[model samples]
Target chain A: MQALSFEQAPPPSVPIRFFLTAPLFMLLAGLLLLIDGEAVMASRWTPAALALTHLMTAGFMLQVMLGALFQLMPVAAGANLWRPSVLALPVHLLSAIGAVLLVAAFHHQIAWAYQLAVVAIGCSVLAFVPAGMLALSRPPGTSHSLIALRIALLAFFATVLAGATMALARAGLIDTGWLRFSSSHVALGLAGWGCVLVAAVGYLVVPMFQLTPAYPRWFARSFAPLMVLAIGLGMVVLHPTAWLPLIGLVALFASVTLDRQQRRRRAKLDATFRFWRFAMGCVLFACAGSVLMIFNIGGNAVALAVGVLAILGGFVSVISGMLYKIVPFILWLYLQPRVQGVPPMTRMLNEQWVLWHLRAHVAMIGAALLATLWWPAVYLVGSLMVVSAALLGGQLLRVVGRARAALRLAQPS
Target chain B: MTDRLPPIVVDARRLLPPEPMERTLEALDEMQPGQEVLLMIPRQPAPLFDMLHNNGYAYTVESQPDGVFHITIRQASGD
Candidate 1:
């Protein structure tokens, strides 16, 4: 067993910085949707649509995922990072700036922007992947979460490399047929990196937060490797039907999560619990959409629906839910000993605001799915998205503000 | 003749996160000198160990067969 090093936990600012900044990207995505609603909703390949997608994925998702890893690796996995506070600065800055540049490159098709974005994001990943790998290499024990985390990191690396190759090709820097691997890039990113990482964290947090029983040992141990294998087979086969196994695997994960959640020990159905349930339902819906793709059922409209369900409906909802629990708990943990009257973690944030955000988010997802079918609904989707992002950002700031107030009160005159 | 108080037992195996840590700290705060506490939790309380060490307490952790962790903690002799 690895000795736990809670002492090595980075100062709260490390993760909190990333958390606080993440929502701005989501807000940016909302603004982009408002500005180019018609073109963005028309098809996935449109410049505005590409910008909108990256703003959510690379901008918002990457920030929170990296931040969570900085905290989670040490506490849960006993994989202490080397000076995490120092490491977080460059990673956060490059990631945020690179994401912006990438969105600009896609939206404007600016050649120089593509080159700069590729370099900036490439360096950010380079800095993070090695540090993460080194920490994960000799974790205290080989828990299933740690095993999945290791694979997820490798997948993240491959995803970034693939993205860089495609970006370079787009900039006319090289023409090695890298664009043909678009599906592979998406597979590695969403499944290999995104879903696997979620699985890794889910194994740890679902039981901890929801008071659910642990995932079955066999499922936890095998899920990440199996996901990677399916993604690999999909890449090699280069056929639409090859995605069936991957889709089945994702559906299995979603169904299993829903099953476990049904038996939660906790009596209260908090926002976080509800968000997870909603996200899982979206995942199942997205799986159905993917199956439609295999059979050429709805064309690009089906593809758009799948994207909406998977990214905005599923990942965004889940990430927002996790932030509610994580940010409050982190703040409470920081203040408990120092502040004379620190609030409980649950009370650290305004629950009314959280509920409002949840409602807005749900409506936003519904609007987005509808917009995929009827493009005019994109305006309502954009508005709800803005409202949702604002509420989430406002609540996070309120928690930080509370922490600051308590700290000030504890100070000696 | 010397009389020693038995260690206080705080069973936190059924509780979640901060509750276990909170209860343990409360027990520690109320402890008499020379008394110890046995905290039973579902998982290794790594963060609590740091808190205890920083606050001049010593602890030993043993894993139980049923998957609970038994952490024995006491104030250091000098403190």
Candidate 2:
């Protein structure tokens, strides 16, 4: 076995900063929705709709996933990162700035914004992908999680490269046919990068936290590679039929996760558990919607609905739930040895507040689903999204604040 | 007669994260000199190994066929 070092685990600040900043992007998405709800709900191709989508995907999702990697790589996979705290600084700043600029570019159709966004986002990806790969080069063991994580990193690189090329094309900097590869870019980003990363981490956390049986070994081993292959095939075929297999694979993952969770030994169904259940259900719904779109059974509205279910309903919900557990656990671990009376991980954040956030989140998803059919409901969806984001951000601050207070008490005057 | 005591066995396979770490540290705290801790955990406790090493402990980790890790930790000589 490769020698492992817990001493290499970055300071909690590294991951915590990313986790805390993520919800602000969600808040920004909510604000954008409220301002341009009509245009956003009109069609997926609208500038406003594009901005809102990137705000969720590139802004919020990217932040949390990166942060989780900085933490999870060391603890779970024994992949020692070189000075994660130092690396996080540039990656976080550039990514957040790039995401904001990208949103601005989409919303205003600004050439300079698009160019700058590509440069900034490209740099951030460059900084991260190499460092991440180096760390994973020799993991302690060849667990399925590590293999999937490696594949996910490669997928992340491809996704960012495609996105950058597209951005430059949009900026009129390079006149190329890369613009026509939008579907491929989306496939690589959402399935190859997003879903695969989630599954990689899921292999460890699902069983560890939920006390469920380990994912079926065969499924765990094949899932990421198959996902990458399917995405590649879809990219090449450039046909809706090519996407069916990809969608089927996504649904399979969600169903298997839900099945495992069903047998969880935990007695208390906390907010995290409920959130995961809701997310899995949304994934199934999104897959059905995708099938409808593939068959041309529904119009542009169905496409929008699928995006809503997958991004907001599925990814956002699951990431938020993970943050609840990860943040508190990190804080508890940090403070335990230093402080005299560090609270249990469960008590770091108020459960009541989490439950309230869950309610808002569920309501927001419902409103968003309705908004697809009836435009007026977009206003309610925007409002509830704002509330949900604010609640999530507030709880994260509460967790940090509690940790700070405990640390201060331990300090010698 | 040898002064070394039988190693304390801590079956932390079922415990959640941090708990296993905490229990291992607690066991080390209570251990008399020359005693060892045989920690049985579901996965390799990578982080705990670093802590043990830093705090002047020596450990050997063996992985079982059934995916359990058997880690034997003791105070390093002259600590």
Instruction: Please tell me which predicted candidate would have the highest lDDT against the true structure.
Output: 2
lDDT of 2 by residue, A253-285 (tens): 999999999987666687888898899999999
What DockQ does each prediction reach against the true complex?
0.37, 0.28
- Predicted model with the maximum DockQ: 1
**What does TM-score give for chain A of every model?**
0.97, 0.97
Please list the C-alpha lDDT of all candidates, in the order they appear: 0.87, 0.87
Cα displacement (Å) at residue A393, model 2: 0.9
In order, the B-chain TM-scores come to: 0.92, 0.90
- Candidate 1, residues B2-77, lDDT tens digits: the string is 6878999999866766778888888988888888899987666766877887788988888988767899998887
Clashes of 1: 0
By how many angstroms RMSD does model 1 differ from the true structure? 2.7
Worst 10-residue lDDT window for candidate 2 chain A reads A1-10
Task: Indicate the residue-level lDDT of B32 in model 1.
Answer: 88
Superposition TM-score, candidate 2 onto the true structure = 0.89
Q: How good is model 1 by TM-score? A: 0.92
Give the Cα error of residue B21 in candidate 2, in Å.
Answer: 5.3
